[model samples]
Target: MRYRALLAFLAAIVAGLMVVSLLVGPAGVGPVAGIAALVDGKGALGLVMREIRLPRALLGAMVGGALGVSGAAMQGFLRNPLAEPGLIGISSSSALGAVIALQSGFAAVSVLALPGAALAGAVVAVALILMLAGPRGPSLTLILAGVAISALAGSFTSLVLNLSPNPFAVTEIVFWMLGSLSDRSMQHVAMAAPFMAVGALLLAPLGRGLDALTLGEDAAEAMGVRLTRLRLMLVLGTAALVGSAVAVAGAIGFVGLVVPHILRPFVGARPSRLLAASALGGAAMLLSADIAVRIIAPERDLKLGVLTAIIGAPFFLHLIWRTRGQIA
Candidate 1:
């Protein structure tokens, strides 16, 4: 009952935030009218509501949920609270791909090019990381490998941006790296949703294995939890989730990192419960952040990734300070 109640509360929050997201845009559509427009498809208001805000809200929820669940899975698998999707370098690689597409002028030619490139980059990065870490490797080894891959990807991305002849392309690269949901269309939803959904499905069933893993690797192995299979699922699932997110909205960081950590205590450190709670909590957080960016700077463009980093970095520093002994 407690667990259900918690989930219900989170769901209610996400639902309310979704409505708020729909109504909070620069279009000036009232909540009631937006709801009506979404349902009836009546006129200009309907067009704006359905075409613009609806996709944004839906994508926000989906992207947030993806990051949240992915983060939870990573933390559980690694037995580290600080584990996040970006730690594996998939997000940076995806951003690099998008930057290349922008610099090459391919993104201008086709709306799909940017996302396609991002997805490809994520796949390649994950493949290389897996190769470097090897199957059934130590978690520490994987983390170190991921750090190397991320640094390499970031360097390449910077090189591309610096070498671009078009100054406008450089600006686009900055925005893409920072992330946003503005001007997103149904096309992006179509491209990212399936991959994210697949990733979710793959990660969702691993809760039991993760919980058993809490008993340590030998115990988990004795209990029939295949570590190699678990690692495969975690890597592939995280790649899909992070890749699809970067493909659609660029790189919104800290979500997967923050949401699971916040919800872990409430879920009693159970990986299973934390998964769902983190998803809902993540959705709510992203929706709230998206709304705040619009309200705080109605005239200026504020990137979603920038806002999240601003909030997450301080929290992360505090976490590090609190765990200084562990690091030492």
Candidate 2:
């Protein structure tokens, strides 16, 4: 009963924020006006509501939920409090693919080029991780493999930036790295949603396996849990969610790390309960941040990723501070 109530409350927060996100844009449309325009879809205001604000709001919720759930799943699978989605290198690799597309001028050829390249990169990274980790390798092996992939991808991205000759391309790449939802279309929402939905399906059922894992591997296996399959699903699902999100939003940081951490206690530290709650909390956090960026600097083009980093970095430091004793 208590858990159900908590889910309801979080869902309510997400819903409220979604509405606020649609209404609170640069156009300054009121609640009633935004709703009417959204429904009517006839005039300029209607176009703005349908084409611009709607997708932005939808992506905000979707991206946030993806990152949040991915983070929670990673932490649960690894049995580590600090685990996050990006630790597996999917986000960086996706960024690398996008960078390659932009640098090579492929992104200009088609609307799907950017995200397609990003997803391809994520797939390569995951394949490499799996190969390096091996099917029966321990959690430590997976961590090391992911770290290696992340460093390699980061270096490659930097190399692309350093060698690029076009000043315009460089500038565009830099801004894209910072991330934003401005100027996003429904096409982007469509591109990312199916992957996120599939990823969610892959992950949502892992609750029981993850809960069994809390008792340790041998015990979990004894209880009919298949550790090998669990690991594979976790990697693929995380890749799908984080890959699709980064493909659309660029490299928004700390969402996966922060949301799950904040909501863990509320869910009694159970991976099963944490997944859903974290998803809701994440959506609220991102939507609120998106709205805040517009309000705080309406004149300036504030990047969503930059704002999240600013908010997340301090919290990350605080987390480290609190866990210092444990680290030592």
Number of the predicted model whose TM-score against the real structure is largest? 2
Estimated TM-score for each candidate: 0.95, 0.97
* RMSD over all Cα atoms, model 1: 1.9
lDDT of 2 by residue, 38-103 (tens): 999989999999999999999999999999999999999999878899998899999999999999
- Model 1, residue 215: C-alpha shift (Å): 2.1
Mind giving the per-residue lDDT tens digits that candidate 1 earns over 97-117? 999888888888777889999
Residue 151's C-alpha lDDT in candidate 1? 99
True lDDT of residue 53, candidate 1: 86
The lDDT of each candidate is: 0.89, 0.92
Specify the poorest-scoring 10-residue window by lDDT in model 1: 318-327
Q: In model 2, which regions exceed 4 Å deviation?
A: 319-328
